[model samples]
Target chain A: GIQVEQSPPDLILQEGANSTLRCNFSDSVNNLQWFHQNPWGQLINLFYIPSGTKQNGRLSATTVATERYSLLYISSSQTTDSGVYFCAVEPRDSSYKLIFGSGTRLLVRP
Target chain B: GAGVSQSPSNKVTEKGKDVELRCDPISGHTALYWYRQSLGQGLEFLIYFQGNSAPDKSGLPSDRFSAERTGGSVSTLTIQRTQQEDSAVYLCASSPLAGGIQYFGAGTRLSVL
Candidate 1:
């Protein structure tokens, strides 16, 4: 069982603003992913960066594995971006299950 | 051209009743998982199936819950004598294999009254 902590438990921003969310894990992991839970409760896979950096559209993520931390950046945010963002990781020893972090709730006002 | 698919996007049942949720993973995926999120809670793991081996059911909360993957493809999660605490959004994910990125379905929202 690995521990995951997400910072800035709540965030509020105006449309077109920028924000950054952070995730810290307790141990080594070979599998890591970022997900967005929409208002309808759909879990959308955002990224699968076990390490290094990746970007998609206005969203970018970087994982510093040696430091056991990951950061997700959202640019030009829109009202549609409002939701809960979660980070999940698989500990090196247990590769089958993903341990999820308490998500950061984001709100983008138009 | 398809992601993971879950059936009966929502389920409402009475206490002491049984319910079954189905998930069809993307073709060729070798791993499937079941998870659920209680209201205002983080996602919680339930069970995992990989290939033809013994599933890792360690995450199941109790004997009332069980899941099986057929032919290493579709999966079904059964809850017997469901309780109020079982109300939540049940999510299913599939990965190419263990340690890979998982693709999730829209999830089945269950309400137990």
Candidate 2:
């Protein structure tokens, strides 16, 4: 089984601040996705960057497949951003399954 | 629906009872998946369906857990003889293909007593 570890298990930031979250996996992956679980428990797909960089609004993610790690950046965060951010990966086995990291719990205070 | 839709946002059942949770994936999506998230924990993969057939069910926790897809659209996860450990948020997600971006629905919160 592949292992996925996320750094800064818990994070608290003042509104308008910036933060970075990292995810490291133990094996090569074919797919990597970042998700935001909001207060309502809604899992919102933030990015599907198996590799490379992408940005949406105040959120951006970059994945270095060769390095077996990915980074997510949130700039000028808002109160609504208070939630858990997850990073999941699908290994090369092609089993159509995702193994998720423990997640970085983020709390943005206004 | 515009996105993945799951029914019975919350369910409370006694132990030894059976419960069924429903999920309707986004139209035209070929891959559907079920996951469980225990309190203060990350998501755990349970099963996946490509069309009406499930190719991999290795993630199911026990024989009491089962799931089925119909018409390649709706999926139902049934848990028979539920236990307290089964109390968790069950989430459903859909992807356009086998290994594509997956969008999730608001999960169903299950509580067994």
Candidate 3:
């Protein structure tokens, strides 16, 4: 089993603010993804970056696999982004199971 | 036709009772997974099913928890003699054979009293 740690357990920001969330893994991974759990309890897929960088809309993510760490950036944050952001990774040895981090809870106030 | 769908959006069961949660994965997807999200907690891996073959049940928390996938399309997670600690959101996800970008269901919120 691998350990995934997320930093800045809680975050609060203005509607137009920006922030970065980090996830560090204990070992190499073959699959890495960022998910946003909405207030309605739907886990939305944000990124599927096992390595390198990717961006969608006002959100972006970078995974430095060699360093066993990943970062998620939210620019021009909106109230809809308020929820729990989780990082999950599957070790190279595992086939389909993903180990998840405790997640960073974000709140954007309008 | 669409994203992963789960049945019985919410379930409330008495302690020591048994309950079943169902998950219908995306069409043509070969990988299905079950996870549990406790209150204010992260998602915990429960089980994984790929195509046919035996499933990886290593993540199941206890003997009381079990899951089965039929025809590689639908899955059912059963909790026997459930306890108060069994209260949580059970989420199901599916990925294509390439195993990239998993799509999740709305999840079944289970409450054991």
Model 1 TM-score?
0.96
Using TM-score, rank the candidates from best to worst. Answer: 2, 3, 1
Residue A103 CA displacement from its true place in model 3, Å: 0.6
**Model 1 spans > 4 angstroms off:** none
Q: Between candidates 1 and 3, which one is better according to DockQ?
A: 1
After superposing candidate 2, which stretches have Cα over 4 Å from the reference? none
Per residue, candidate 1 scores C-alpha lDDT tens digits across A1-110 of 78999988999999999999999999999878999999888889899999999999999999999999999999999999999999999988884799999999999999
- The lDDT values for all models are 0.93, 0.94, 0.93
Clashing pairs in 2: none
Q: Provide the lDDT at B20 for model 3.
A: 99
lDDT of 3 by residue, B5-102 (tens): 99899999999999999999999999999999996666888998988778889889999999999888999999999999999999999999646788
Query: Residue A103 lDDT in model 2?
Result: 95
lDDT of 1 by residue, B1-113 (tens): 28999988999999999999999999999999999988666699999999998999988999999999999999999999999999998999999988788899999999999
Q: B1-113 in candidate 2: lDDT tens per residue?
A: 79999989999999999999999999999999999999666689999998756457988999999999988889999999999999999999999999899999999999999
Model 1 residue A67 lDDT score: 96
Worst lDDT 10-window in candidate 3 chain A: A90-99
Cα displacement (angstroms), candidate 2, residue A83, comes to 0.5
Q: Where does model 1 sit among the CAPRI classes? A: high
